[model samples]
Each structure stands twice: as structure tokens, then as C-alpha cells.
Target: MGLKKYTNINNIQGKKGSQFSSQLRGINLERVLIVAIDAAKFYQKALLCNYYGDVLERPFFFGVNQDGLNLLCSKIEEARMEIQAERIFIGVESTAHYYEDIVYELGKRGYGVTIINPATTYEERASALNWSKTDDLDLYAIAHALIQNKGMENKLPEGAYRKLMKLTRARRSEVQKRALVRIQIRTLMDHIWRDYQGFVEIENNKPKKKLIFSDFWGKSSLFFMEHFPHPSSLIDLGEERVWEISKENKLRIKETHIQTLLYVARKSIIKSTEVVSAELLLLRLAIKDLKRLDENVGLLEKEIEKELLQTDGRLLLTVPGIGVVTAAEFYSELGDISHFDNAGQLIKKAGTNPIIIQSGGTQGFYGRISKQGNKHLRFMVYTVGKSLAQHNKDLRPYYERLKERGKHARKAFIALGNKFIKIAFSMLKNRKPYESKQPDYRIFTEVKKKLLYTKMNTYLNIALAA
Candidate 1:
């Protein structure tokens, strides 16, 4: 069948045209063909359009495999030839991992690609046309958004940064799995030994005593659970046997722990029996899984550390309290800080920037953060910010001042997060290690004045050179 044509560019030239014109200044629209694909798991729905949001062809469907990618590329070539376009710009919605293969394929075929956030396409649909949803409609929205330049340039990580991301993400997944197993173990313990937590308590000078097994996932606790699944089993083994088991497992605990366990076992309301054998089995399985996950996490961390050392990530370690893990996370997420124009952009990308709410002539008040960017990066920034607020010399005073001014704990943390972004950005951009001492006010003033006079590109070049 012949390709369908849409020549009424003026109809879409009102708001979308102006937005595109402002954001996309240099690109000549007349010679460029825009291809937007609504990516899915099994298939992709695509629309080919011209520079001014004119559809040059009807929506096309293609598979996601090798044959499908080739068909899609051939269709794109056909569209380019029909439109007599000099360049092709392919736009695809970033729908999880569904778009990765297509994007990589398009890149390998030498097409300029933009990865549009699904949120952007949704907003575009809502604003441009109040229509029902379909694959074709979604494809239209993606194409429309691309013509308006409402997407990010698709640039995948490479080298050490790529490996770091893979390792860190795997580690995070394993940690989450481990946490789930711990919860399951705790739930099983509640049924089999409800007051097991009270067995060993250390008397501190503080009012609240500390339980040794409060960390339910500790090595000793897991060993105890695996060997003696219930209180009756523990009592049957006797205190000396328990101590012997602890010694065999190389657990550094006092003999008093055994006495505590025996006492709690005698007073325990729950008793072990053949009926509870199922619970014991579950407990043993959970412990085994937890141990495997722990080993996996440790191995992934070691690999992450090794990969991080190969990059300039070690420079981040110069900042007090920013250890290898936090630094590696930042490196993996940011993927070369030189790409960012300024620290504010980095902060916004991390989603720590405060959201301002206002309407009409009303004054705007700062609400919570947008939380619209990389949540993992935001979490890492928050944790690093908390550490800095407590320990970093310059940041601690700032944190205390905010607290003294009655700022909420979370708000203070957000503020510290913002500060951390700025400091880290400057340090990384300038290739300078962090200094604990605060700079002189005079030097700060001079630096601010110099920044004002310096062109942005020139400043970036200088920073990159450093």
C-alpha cells in the first residue's frame, strides 16, 4: 500500500511550533524527517512526520526482534526517500527497557535519536488533544512531542561508568531481596518464638536497654535460627551445646548469652513440636537465601569498588563522609558531570529541588521536592547529605543553623542535599578535591564576580581542563 500524507502543518503551528522554535534554534526543520515510535514489549507502533509536525505516512507496526528492527529501519528509509529528507530524527518513548534495543539499533543505523519521557508524552496529549488513548494516539503524541523538542538526547553510558551502573543496580536488587527474606524470617520467628528478642539485653547507661539480637539479620541470629528453629529445640540442645555451636560458628559472644537464651526458652509461651516443623523448614530456607544474598551483595560491592577505582570517582572520596559506595553511586548516576551546565541542573535532575506552587497574582510558597527524576540518585544524595550535615566541618554549621532556625528535619536534609549537589558539582567540574576549610569571603566574592563576567561555555571549558 502507498504511504499516507499529512500536509496541514499550519494546524499544529500554534503552541507546539513556538515551543519547538524556542527550544530548537539551530536545526533546519525543512530537511529533517521525524520518526516517533511508541515502544512496547512485543511490538512498536510508529509514525513518520516532517519538520513541521506533518505526518508523511500512516502509523506502522513492527516487531521488536531483529527482523522487526530491520523492517522499521527500511520503512524509515522509505519515508526519508519519499520526503526527500536530508536527516532523520527518531523519537521513542522511554518505556522501561522496551526501547533500549530499538534505540541502540537506530543509533547503529546512524539516526539522531531522542528518548522522550512517557510523562512528557502524556502531558503533550492532554494539552494538544483531548482524545481517547490508543497505540496510534500514543505514537502521534510522541511524534508531536518530538517536533516540539520535548525530549532528552539518548546517550548511553560506556566503559567504567557502564559497569559501575550494572554492578550498583544488581547490588541494590540483592539488598532488597535480602531485606524481604529478613522480614519473612522475622514473621516466622513471631509465630515460633515471639519473645526471642528479649533473650539477650545489654544494660547501657541510657534508659533504653539494647538487645543484641535487635539486628535480626545478624550472623549469630541467622545461625541460631537455622540450628534451633524453636525455643523447645533450643532448650533440648542445652546451654553448653548452644555455646559450643556458637564457638563452632566463630560467633564472638559471651557465655551469658546462652544463659539468657535458656531463661527465655523456659519462660517462652510458644513451644516447638512436630506441628511447627513446617515453620522450621521455612526459617531454614530463609536463612539460607539470606546468606546467599549476602555473599552476592558483597561480591557485587567488591566489583563496584574495583570499577570505581578505575574512574575519577575516587576524587569524590576527598569529601568527608562520602565513601566509596556513595561516590560510586554518584558516578554511576551522573555519568560524567561535565555534561551538566550547572549545579542547579544537577540538583533538579536528582529531584531535590523544591517545588513552587502559585496561581494568578498569589505569592508562591515552596512545597516539597518534585521527585520527578532519578529516585535512586535522590536517595544517595539524601544519605550523603545527612552524613555531611553531621560530620563535614562547613556543612555541620550550616545544618545546625538551619535546625536552630526551626527547620524540620526533612526540610533541613533537603537543604543539605541541595548544598551537597552544588559542592560536588563544583568539585567534580573543576577536578578539585574537597577542602574542609571554608573559603575566605573575599575569595568567594571575587569568584562570584569572575563567574558573572565569564561566558558559560568558556567557564565550562576551563573547569573541564582543570
Candidate 2:
């Protein structure tokens, strides 16, 4: 229930062969410096040597750029130059927004760079937080996490991944800018004209300032303001003039709207103003930015699909529920499947493993993921699992089976996703495509019969006792 109860899977008691093997084989990790950066804010911490659930050296203050990543590469380069020892592993958490700078530089330098989840480092720091948070202690926690998870198989992202990461980040930026500008546009509209509030129609329900044109073709909005232009100027001009304009616009207008346009134009008049030009400019720029981002996303998706069809890529993609994108992401991140000796390492990376809460005589579990591994990989798997559950008939039986055994729907879904992750890992390691495993329907039927029989027996026994 508290910090003391949090446990790490440091040891695997099971043996694979004649002798026992460590779940993780430790490197001389004390020579390592693990770096973690929070991308949303300008925060980064670096710990010296072997801290990923291991203890060797302490953590320290690391620097992030004013933009959270501008200076990241320089810091990595400096660390590599200074720590001219056995090895240097820089582990960074994937804080949603892409850390292309960090991943590219560290991976380029041949350092054991890992893109992990920030929650993992947070859990690691739980023990060390006596008072408050500091960059120094954070670096230590990250370093400790690296040590604890030594022999941690990091999934090295590929070229397509880089492209995906870059495109996704750009898309996020454009989306943010649009959000701000949209607010300003909405505020302006509400102030000038509140009659048409919520009447604006959007094709896909997406918000856009350009849709405001539906309220005023040109003169209508201008006519509303006393100092602006007037709709009445075009009124007495006759039906032919309005028809010519509608024809030019290709507008499908009914007779009633045509009449209203004529009447309103006759009734509405005002002076000309300059606000329309600026509004038009902002709208044009916003539309252009959104379109450009969409284009890049399309290109990135195509490349990822191409990479997915690579020989090894084909093997991964053939797995149930692991489609082109998922397979590509998995392949890119996990360069080699043989690196992981077992499924737990893979599961840990999936971030689906439950964290335990135990104290005194009571032992229980909390519904938090051990977010200490490949967060991106974990999310990918979870997403794939959901997709599979909806579409993959093969995984449906397994999911139903698990849910029937009293797992929470969301939890069971993730558990199912984790289950698929293991299967996918196997298919990758064996260089074989996924083949659906048919359910033993008879076996399930027999089990259900036995359960019913047992219930009957219990009921009879209670009757006799009564």
C-alpha cells in the first residue's frame, strides 16, 4: 500500500537448463551514466552508473534545453567524452512528445540508449524521496533504474521509427497552434455575432475557422457591424446578380434561401472595415499548416508500411493482431529478438505487469503498471491487443477465457495484450509467422461440466447438513 511495499523483479528463481540463470545478466554497469528527460518541461536528470533497480553510484543533475531537447545532444556528447571507460548507457523516458534529438545522437554514438517510461524512474525515486525533488536525486534514480534493469534489452528504433517519431511530433505542434488560434477565432465570432453559435457545420466534426464563412458569404458579417460594409449594396442589384454569385460559388441554394438573401441584403447595410483581411490571412495560414502536417504523416505511414514488408518484417507482421504499423514499430524498437532470453523482460517492457502493494500480514495488489520499461512498446502492444480483440477472431477466445476467470475488462484486455506480446516475441525469435491456435472446445466443455457438477455436489451436501 506504501513505498516500502513496492518490489522489483530482481531475480527469477526458475531454471532454463541444468543450472539456474539470472533473469538479467549484469554488465559492469557502475561505469554507466543513465540520463532521463521530461520532454514537456525543461527537466533532465543523469545518474552515474548502474541504477535501474540496482545500486552502485548516485544520481546527479542533468540539463535539458530551454526547449527540452535543443541541448540534449550536446550533453550526451559531453558525457560520452568524459566517461571514457568501459561503457555509457543513457536511458531516457519517452515523455509523449518525441525525443528525436536524444535518441538520434545517443544511438548514433553507439551508446546503449534506451527510450523508456518516466513512470519507471518515478517508482525508482520513491525510496529516495525523503523531502522534495531535485535534479540531482532524479539523475540518481534513473541511474539506479538502469542498474536494476541491467542486461535490459533495449529495442533500438529503426529508420521508419525515426520518421514516425518526427512526423507525429510535428503533427502535435500544429495541433497545439490550431487549438490556440481556434480559441481566438471563436472569441471574435462570439463577440461580433452570437446568433449563429454552434450552428457552424464541420465535415468530420473537426473545428475550423473557415467554417465561419457559412455565417456571412461576405457582406452579411460586414453588414452586422455599423462601421463595416453593408449587405444591402447587393440587394436591389436584382435576382440575376445573386444567381451569378451563387453559380460562381457552386452553391446548392433553395428558392427560400435565395429570397431571404435578397431580402436580407436589401435590409442590411454598413460601412466597410479591414478585419476580414486579417481573419482571412490567419485562416489561410492555419489551413496550410494543418494540410502540410497531414501530408508528412501520410508519407511516414507509407514508409513504415514498406519497412513492414521487409523479410524479417514480414515474419513479425504475420503475427495475429500485429499489423503493418505495429509490426514495424516492434521490429524497429526491438532490433533483435534474440536479445531477450525470456518473456518477463519483454513483459516488463510492455508495462502491463502489475505492481504489488504489501505490508505486515496483508498482501495485495494495486492496479498500476510497472511503467519501468519500453513505454512506447507497451502502449503499442496494448493498442494492438485492443485492435485484435475487436477484429482477430483467434484472440477472441483467449480474451473471453481470461475475462470469465474474473479479470477486469480493461485489465483483462491489457493482460490479453501482454499475452499477444509474448506470442509475437516468440514468432519473431523463431523467425516464424503467427499461426492461430484453435481452442480445445471439448476441453472447455468438460471443464464447464465439472464446475456444474461440483456446484450440484456442494448444494446436495448443504441440504444433507441442514
Number of the top-ranking candidate, with TM-score as the measure:
1
**Model 1 ranges with Cα > 4 A deviation:** 1-30, 128-135, 199-215, 355-372, 390-393, 400-408, 438-466
Question: lDDT tens digits, residues 1-466, model 2?
Answer: 6655212343242222112123233444344445544333444444444323343333333444334333554565566556543455566656655454556655655655655557766776786687446645655555555545532334444555555544444544555665675565455444433322333335788854322235542343322222222244344556787666656656655545556545544433332325345543554454455456555655656655544443355455444455555556655544455656777667765667788888888978666777656665676667777777776677888788878888777776787778876777787677655575545333223222322113434433432453
Computed on alpha carbons, the lDDT of every model, listed in order, comes to: 0.74, 0.52
- Per-residue alpha-carbon lDDT of candidate 1 for residues 412-456, written as tens digits (9 for 90 to 100): 877897898888888778767667675542322322332322344
Instruction: Please report the candidate that would top lDDT against the real structure.
Output: 1
Quote model 2's TM-score: 0.53
